[model samples]
Structures are given as C-alpha cells and as structure tokens.
Target: MVSAARTATETRTTTRTEARRAPDIVAGVADADKLTDEIAATSVDPRLWTGAFATNVWGGRFAIDGVLGEGAQGTTFQGTDLKTGGRVAVKVFDVGRAKDWKALQLFDREADTLKSVDHPGIPKLLDVIVDQETGARALVRTLVPGESLAAEVKSRGPLSEAALWSVIVDVTDVLGALHGRSSPIVHRDLKPANLIRRPDGKVCLVDFGGVGRMRESAGSTVVGTFGYMAPEQLYGAQTPATDMYAFGATLLTLATAKEPEELPRQGLSIDVEAAAAKLSPQLRALLTKLTAPDPSGRPADAKALLAELHAIADAKDRPAAEPSWPEPMVDSPFAARGTDGDFLVGIVGVVFGVLGVVGAIIVGQLLIPLVLTIIAATADGAQKERILAARARVVEAAKVAQRSFERSAQHGARKLESASERERDRAEHRRRRKRELKRHWKDEERRLKQLAKDAKRSARRDGRFWV
Candidate 1:
C-alpha cells in the first residue's frame, strides 16, 4: 500500500513537471501564457520577432519565417504557405497594443482595398487571419519579390536620370490604374521605402496602410509619412493630387538621396529646381507642379499626368532639329555688319576717285576725260558682273548641299523605321512565346496542387495526418 501511494505521488510529480516544461518548438504560440509573455517582452525590448523557431498559425497553413519590416500599423513577416509551399508576406496587427483606434481603421481599409484591386504591380491578398486568443489580426499576401527602392538607392547611390524617370513612369502607370477606378484609390503614402524594384526593372507598390478612396470622408488625423505627404494631407484632405505630391517627393528622394524636407525649399514648396538640377527641365517642371503647395497647381488627374509624361517621353525620342546656319554666314557682308563700316569705306573711295579723275584730266589731252569715263564704266560693269556670279554660285552651292542633306536624312529615317519595325515584331513574338510558357506553367501548377490535395486526403484516410 505504501509502494502504491509512492507510485501515485511520483506520477503526479512527473505530470506537474511536464506541464511546467512546455515545448519551445514553436514561437509566440507554444503556450498561451508563453505567448502573452513573449508579446510583452517584444513590446518592451523593441527587438524583432525573428521566428527562428516555427510559428504555425491557422492550423499550420502558414509558417512565419522572420520579420520583414515594422510599420506604423503592424509588423510584416516573411512566411510560407504550407499547402502550396509558396512564399508570402504576413502583416500582423496586435490589437491589444495598438497606439490608437485609427490604426485599426487603417488596417481594415488596407485589407479592403487590397481585396478590391488586382494588378501586377500590387500584392494580391491571399488570406486574412485573426487570432481570438491574442487579439492579433494578420493579412497574408503574395510576396513581392525584390528589395525596396530605398535600400537600392542606399546601396547603389542615386539612380541615373533615365533610370529615375523610368521608375517614376512605372509608378505613375500603376497609379493611373489605381486612380482610374470608379472610387479612385489614393496611395496616401508614396516613398522610396514603400516601392519595391523587381529584377526585371518593374516596380511593385506595397504597404496599403495609408490607402484611401477618393471622396471618402476624412478622418481627424492624417495618415502619411511627413516627408512624402502633401500640404493638404496634413489637414486630412486626400485626393489623387495628394498622391501626385507624394510621387514628386519620392522622385526627389530618388534623385538626391535625401528626404524632401531636407532639401532646400522655397517657402512651403520644395525647390525641385535645386533638388533635381541634373534632371531634365520637363521632369523638374513636372516635379514642381506635382509638389506645388496648392492642389490646383498640380495635374488635374492621373490621366492628365500620364499624358504629360508620355509627351515628355515622345519629345525625348524625337531627333533634334538640325542646327540652322548663322544669319551672318548666309547674309551679304554689307548686311551683316552695320552701315558704319560701309559708310567709312564709301568716304575713302570718293576721295581716291576724285584724286584719280583730277590726275587723269591734268596728265592727258582733251579726250582724256572721255577716255577715262569710258574705261571706268567698263571696269565697274565687269566688277558688278563678277560679284553677281560669285553670289549666285554660293547660293546654288548651299541649295545643292541642303538637297544632299535632305536625301541622306530621308534614307536614314527609312532605315531606322525598318529596324524599329523588325524589333517590334521580334518583341511581339517573344511576348507570345512567354504567354504560352506561362500558360503551360500554370497548368503544371494546378496539377501539382491537385496532387498535393490528393496526398493530404490519402494521409487523412490512412490516419497518418495530424493537425
């Protein structure tokens, strides 16, 4: 009986120890008490939750790998979808520790906006997860694979003018789509950090935390980064023009590798002239209009802005006009110079003529005056004829040269057009091939997904699957 009692006591002791020593195989969700403790610890330490240990959420559908970034709304994590084994970005908002109610509202709005839109330059929403226990909400999205523009600029220095323009063009094109919707969406915060540059030079916009619809009622507090926000955005007035301002600010940052506010400013306006001095005048002017203190000074809409940008691009593509010959080179010598020099020459000629005529009359007989007159007339006529012939020859030579240049230019233009057409055809063929390959890969992906589903079902039927 003593031995039996001792065994029971030992068993109880073992059970208590096991309960105290909870497994650490998973992070933040190992045990309720541990998760709470971790949450508190992370809040106090300000260190990222690396997720070195697996964090299985939503019944192991997603396993967060590590923290990708921290933002005003929440923390974003690099994670993997267990079902498809595809990478995803997981944004988690801890409601319990939210700074204010506005954060929650912004989170909801972002989720809604993401769900409503579908574009290649934007992240696609995959799933939404809410933890009842910890009061944590998460958004799962397809990972936009690339480094942020901020990071790229930091490592590589300021982008070249062409590259910067291309970046802005890509961004504006994406914005055009966003703003073209019935209830246009404004990306309230547009900056280098929120823009991702892909390997193929495509830009992907992320962090819809400050996204707002046009005509939406304004909140009391503004939602945007200070350096990238428009003046009106400070008063919680957001529109497509507000985004234009942010884009302008972003361009400034990319061009100068400095914040908009850090650059020289003229009153409330950013001195884009000083900030982007190396950029084209058109780009500078566009920046000035976009970052104008008043909304009316900016482009009316994204479409108008796009048209202006395209116009600038077309102007760039066109060949420059041939430099015209200077007026002095083509005009008569007397016409080029002022009449002062001609007048002086005429005075000297008159004096010489009088001396010549007096000498001829004094040294010759009575017929001398008449002979001199005839000789002078003949000489003047020959001089006039020679001058006329020379002028005519020069004019004709210029015409011939102009005609040759015109012919050459025409032939060169024809060659360039043919080459451009051939290149366009090649590009189209490449696009077609790429589309076929994409379709084939998509089919393969679907088949693999089906196979995975079947395997999971088989495992469940065999009693080998565990949730």
Candidate 2:
C-alpha cells in the first residue's frame, strides 16, 4: 500500500508539470493576442504592420518593442523611461576603452541638449536613464518614421538633381530652426548616416549622440566625422560656421558618392568635384563661405548661411539670360555656367570632355563672319564659289561626322550594357552555386550528426550487453 501511494504521488507530480506547461501556452497566446490587437487598433497603415510593432509610449513609459534596424549603433531596441514610462531608444554604445568615459559623457550631454530643442525634423527628447546594474543608458526620444539616408543611397544608387535639391532645402530648414533658437544647436556630425528620409521624402536629422550646444567642449578631441567636417572643424572651434562647413561637406557627399575625406587630397581631376562646377557662380561663391578654410570667412550663423543659399537660388531664376547661339542650340542651362561647347560650331560634345556641334557653332560664329568678309573682299566669282563649296563640304562633313559619332556612342553604350548584364548574370550564377554548395555542406553535416547519434546509441547498447 505504501509503494502504491508513492507511485500515485509521482503520477500527480507529472500531472502538475503538464498543467503548468498548459498555462504557459495559454498565457503566451494571450500576450500575443494583446499585442496583435493593439497593433491592429493603432496601425495607421494596415498594409505596413504585418511584423512591425507600433512604438508605444504608454503612461510616460517608452516602449520600443519593434524591429531594431541594422544600423551601426545598436539603437534599434525597445525600452521605457523609468521616470515617465515613455517609449525610447536604448542604443548600446560599444565605445572602445580609449574613449569610454568621454563617449558616455558626450552621449549624456547630447540627450540633455536635445531636450531644449523644438523642431519637426528633430526627435523629441523625453529623458535619459542609465540602468543602475548595467550602466547602459537609454536616451529616450520620439520615434522617427523614416529610414536613414545612407540606406536610401545604398539601395537607390545616386539621386537626381530635383531630389538632391529637395533634400538640401530640408537640411537648410532644419539648420535654420536649430540655429535660430536662443542657444544655437550645432549638429557637429552632419553626414548621410545621421539623416533619415521619411515617406514624404523630407529629411529628419537624428543621432544627436554627437550634438552639442555652442559651449560644449567639442567633446575631448577632433570629433567631427571625416569628409563631412568643415576645414575649421578638423582643427578648431565647433562654431556655427563650422557646422555650415560640415553641412556643405555633407551636401558634397550626397552629390558625389566619394566622401569629403577624399576631397582635399584629390588634385586637378576634380571631376569628383563636378558638383562645384555645376553650381551657378552665386552658388559657387556661397560654397566658398560655407566651406572656407578660414572659419571667419564663413557665415556667423546657420540663418546667414541659409539666406545666402536662398539668395543664390533667387539670382539663378532672375539672372540675365545667357547669350544664346543659333548654331549649338544654346539655352539657359548652359548659359548658367558659360563653358559649354554647345555654343561653338565645329566642336562636338565629345566623350563628356569635348563639346561637339556646340563648339563648332561658337567657333563657326567667328569663322562664318570671317568667311563672309573674305567672300566680299574678293571680286572673283570662282573664289566665292570655291569658298561656298568648301563651306558646304565642311558642313556636310560635320553632319556625317556627328551621325557617325552618335552611332558609335550608341554602339558603345549597348556593348557596355551587354557586358554589365553578363557580369551580373555571372555574379548571380556564382551566388546560386555557393548556395548549392552550402546546402550540400549542410547535408553532409546532418549525415555526420546522424552517424554520431547512432554511434552513441550503439555504444550505450553495447555497454548494456557487456554488463
């Protein structure tokens, strides 16, 4: 009777374990259900929220229970502010030992500084809290609805003129708002990585982890990002002009994929600096101030810098129409910046280097007058006919040459397209082959695992047999 009673207790214990597991399953289901319901109720765009979580700030607590993006900063985590229970970002800073203290201090200051700003492009600062046990700080701010500009550039390659102009306007607007404040906010770090593009295509500046008020001790070192820092920023004060310089550098970056890190060093072929060439003279002049090697040469504040840009844009629209030539089809776009060969006759807009028919016409503009004078000076009809004949032949030859050059260019483009397609196909094939190889390797691993399992089972059975 005692043995049977002990067996009954063991069976009851097993039943209790199963019952506990049953409640876990139910509770998990309920929790999932609650989240799903909340998501369904609050989701503005149902098509977008299949797996995305609505960052909720309930009762002052910050909750970021959603997809953490693949940014360098482990910023994509969910957390809540203890004081306010507001949803906030818990970015894990992995600063190496060399600058750990300095980095943390900067981060704290950035959060505090952000709390003073009120801009649409900027994330709203809620609070900053460091876990007492872990020392991990959650810099709480409003969740921005956008993707980083770096991601956009990577996914979409380079942007168009209109798109770039629009982004520039936004950056200017944000800068205006920040600098216009009582205490100027300097985004010491203005690079593609820190700017986000919302669904509306407007830019939002983020990651104030590097932001500072005009007075913050530029934070322990030469801290601005390379290629994006104003020349003065590299070695001097972090003033408003320094920020403008960085802003220009950032714009240069968007215009050319090549970072400003490569700019100062690249001599002559500044084709990489074509962005400089493309700008109107006023814009060119404006950039000089914004990116001046001398900080004093630049505008005193962001407001002045923005006004300069606006003035340049305005001048471009109102400038006297550039002298147009009938020969090269000269228009305002070329007139905006004078060196187009399209105005000259005999010059072909060659492989992006030579301006073709345009060059020819401008030269023809001078040559035709000379030819006319020569024809009038000579009383010989035969000489006039010869000159006219020579001109006709020259004109016909130019037409033939133009057509030939165009066909050759078209052929070259087609060839390049074909080669690019082949290369892409080869790359895709290699990728697929690698995937197959991985699958085969995985199969071999599974086979080996099965063998090890069988061997262990056999050893156990043989031990029993030996016993």
Candidate 3:
C-alpha cells in the first residue's frame, strides 16, 4: 500500500505540471503564427496587403475602399471620409519596402508640397497618417475624378487639335500657377500618366511624387520616367524647363497618337516635328522648342510657354486682313475741261473787249494824229513838227496795248495747262492704285485658298472627322 501511494503521488505531480504549462504553449503558438503572418506580408507584393489596408482606418477618419493604382513608390486607394462622407485618394508609402532613402524623402516631399498648395488643378491634402502596426505612411487627398491622359489617348486615339489645345492650355495654366508660386514647384514627371482629364474637359495634375522645389538642390536620385525625362533630368538636374521638356513629350504623344518612347528619333532628340508634320507651323515650332535637347533651347518657364501658346491660338483665331483699296477719285471730264475753258474764255473775252476799246481809242487817236499831220502840212514849220510828234506817240501807245493783251492770253493758257496736268496726274494715280489693289486682292485670295486646302489636308491626316 505504501508503494502504490508513492506512484500515485508522482502521477498527480506530473499532471499538475502539464496543466500549468498548457497556457504557456498556447501563447507560444499564437506568437509563432503572428510572426509567420508578418513575414508573409513583407515577402510578397505590397499590393496583396492592399485589401487589408483598405479596410483599415487612416488618419482615424478615412476608410480606404480599393486599390486605384500601384507604383514604384506606393499604392493609391480610393477612399472615403467617415466624418464627411466625401471621396478621397489614399496613397500609402511602405517605407519598409522603399528602394532607397531618397524614395522616402520624395514621398515625404510630395506630402509636404500638397499640403501647402491651394490650386484647383492640384489635389488638396486632407490628412497624413502613419500605420502604427506596420510603420507604413499614408497621404489622404481630395479624389481627383478622371482617367489618366495616357489611358484617354490610348482609347480615343490622337486628340483633335482643339481638344489637344484645350489640354495643353489647361496643363500650362496649372504649371503657370505652380511655377509662379513664391517657391516655384517643378513637376519633374510631367507625363501623360500624371495628367488627369476630368469629365468637364479640364485637366488636373496628379501624382506629385516627382515634384520638387525649383530652388532645391538636385536630388541624389533622378525621379522621372525615361522617355519623358529631359537630358538634364537624367543627371538629377531639374528645373522649370525640365517640366517643360516632359510637357512637350506628353503633348507630342497626344498629337501623334504614339508613345514618346515608341516615336522615331533623331539621335538623342525626338523627331516630334516629323510625327506632327500635319499640325500648324506654330504648334510644330512650339513643340520642337519645348522638346529641344538642350534645356536652354526650351522656353524659359511655363509662363513663357503659356504666352507663346496663347499667341499661337490668337493667330489661329484672328481673321486675315482683306486687301483694302483707296477709293477712286471721280473726275468729270466736262467739268475739268469746262473749268479751265470758262476761266480762259472769261479772261480772253475781257481782254479782247478791252483791246477792242483800246484799238478804237487808238484809231480815234490815230485819226487825230493824221488830222494833226495834215494841219501841220497846211501850217508853218513849228506847227507841223508838233503834230508829227503827237502822231508818233499815238502809234507807240497802240503797240504797247497789243503786247499787254498777248502777255495776258499767254498767262491764262499756262495756268489752264497746269490745272489740266494736275487732274491728269491724279487720274493716273487712281488707276494705278486700283490695279495694285486688285492684284493684292487676288494674292490674298490665293493665300486664303491655300490655307483652306492645307487645313483640309491636315484634318484628313489627323483623322479628324470635323474640321
């Protein structure tokens, strides 16, 4: 009996020990399962965890819906504000998975930049959060509505000139706003994928992940896509013109219905002019200059580019000036001739009437002189000398009157000739002006017709059904 009791006591002691260790084993198993889950989450694509993250509350208010997109930096989700029921875009930056320290800095830079910007084209930063459990960061912003410009171009082919112009103007205006800021911001990645075309036909810039301050020093890592990036950008040298280069490449793709990388090239530069040959010369030139391999060759800034675009649009809309001709001077042949004729006739008539009176007087005086001469012949030597002198003086006075009348008639004729010559010259000038104006009008008409024909050809080439 004593031996049985000892074995039983040992058995009881073992059972109590096993019972005490059960809770510890259970706790250890639970910890191992959690460690395994964490390892799986980090090892696989971050996208796989999107569903779990979407369900989680961000910034204690935003409820993520679904994955919108994923990029090298992070994953974006369509989300909702539980407080206001408004839509938002939640960008989660898993810093743990970042390739480099610069990526994390850029992600933080984008958040900081968005928080201060208040433009309509830019999404407003709503909230920022750091997932306590996973150490992931999230940025909540206003949901920008629209597909990417890249997708739109892919589905719709090349945009019409007007449509393309709208897109360019909208984007340029946005850039103007950004670059005009106190501390100008450069959108280093100004590609089609970063541009959002809203339903209202306005374009908004999204994904500011590649944005940087103009005054900031070049980053250690380049932060733009390959084909759209400027040469300087490849070396991490970014400026407003850097954005212009990307803008040019984006527009070139839209204008030609081809990807920037897929388009033909001329050495290191893109042959955009060749691809967009059917576009207007002004547009072609603008794109060419914007995409110039050298940054200096591009526009100085977005504002300058916007001005040039406005000028081009203004030129396109301005009506061509029609050839104008000076009104022809109406000359009445009878009136012109009659004016001179009447004056000449009046002067000649008055002169002739005066001359007739003078002649009569002279004749009368001659008769007197003749009578005097006769008297002289009958009288003595002294009376005959005086009568002969009086006759000679009367003859000389008659000769003077005839000379005066000839001089007056010649003056009147000269004046009439000068007036007629002036009228002739004026008439010739009017005829010449009329001929020149007609020629100019014909030339203008031909130019307009050629412009119309070229426009038609361009429309056909661009695959536009409506001109």
Error of 1 at 378 (Å): 36
lDDT of 3 by residue, 225-300 (tens): 8889988876677889889999999999888878788988899788867788888777788888999999889987
lDDT of 2: 0.56
Off by over 4 Å in 3: 1-55, 215-219, 317-319, 322-467
Give one digit per residue, the lDDT tens place, for model 2 in 202-245: 89887776666665233445657866776555553577766787
Best by lDDT: 3
Worst 10 residues of 2 by lDDT: 21-30
Write the candidate numbers in order of decreasing TM-score: 1, 3, 2
Q: Candidate 1, residues 1-467: lDDT per residue as tens digits?
A: 99999999999865654343221324333355644344333332222221221134443577654557677787676767777777889887777788888889889888887776756688867777775545677788789888999998899899888888788778887788789998889989999999999889899899999888774345577889988998888777888988989998998899999988899999999998888898888889989998998988998668879878756754554335312212232334333333234334444444554444444334332344444455556666777566555545545554555455455445545544544454444345445656876996799689768866865574565332221
Off by over 4 Å in 1: 1-41, 44-54, 216-218, 322-467
Q: Which ten residues in a row have the lowest lDDT in candidate 1?
A: 45-54
C-alpha lDDT values of all predictions = 0.70, 0.56, 0.72
Per-residue lDDT for 413 in model 1? 50
What TM value does model 3 have? 0.58
- For model 3 the local lDDT of residue 340 reads 47
Q: Which prediction has the highest TM-score against the true structure?
A: 1
Q: Rank the candidates by lDDT, best first.
A: 3, 1, 2
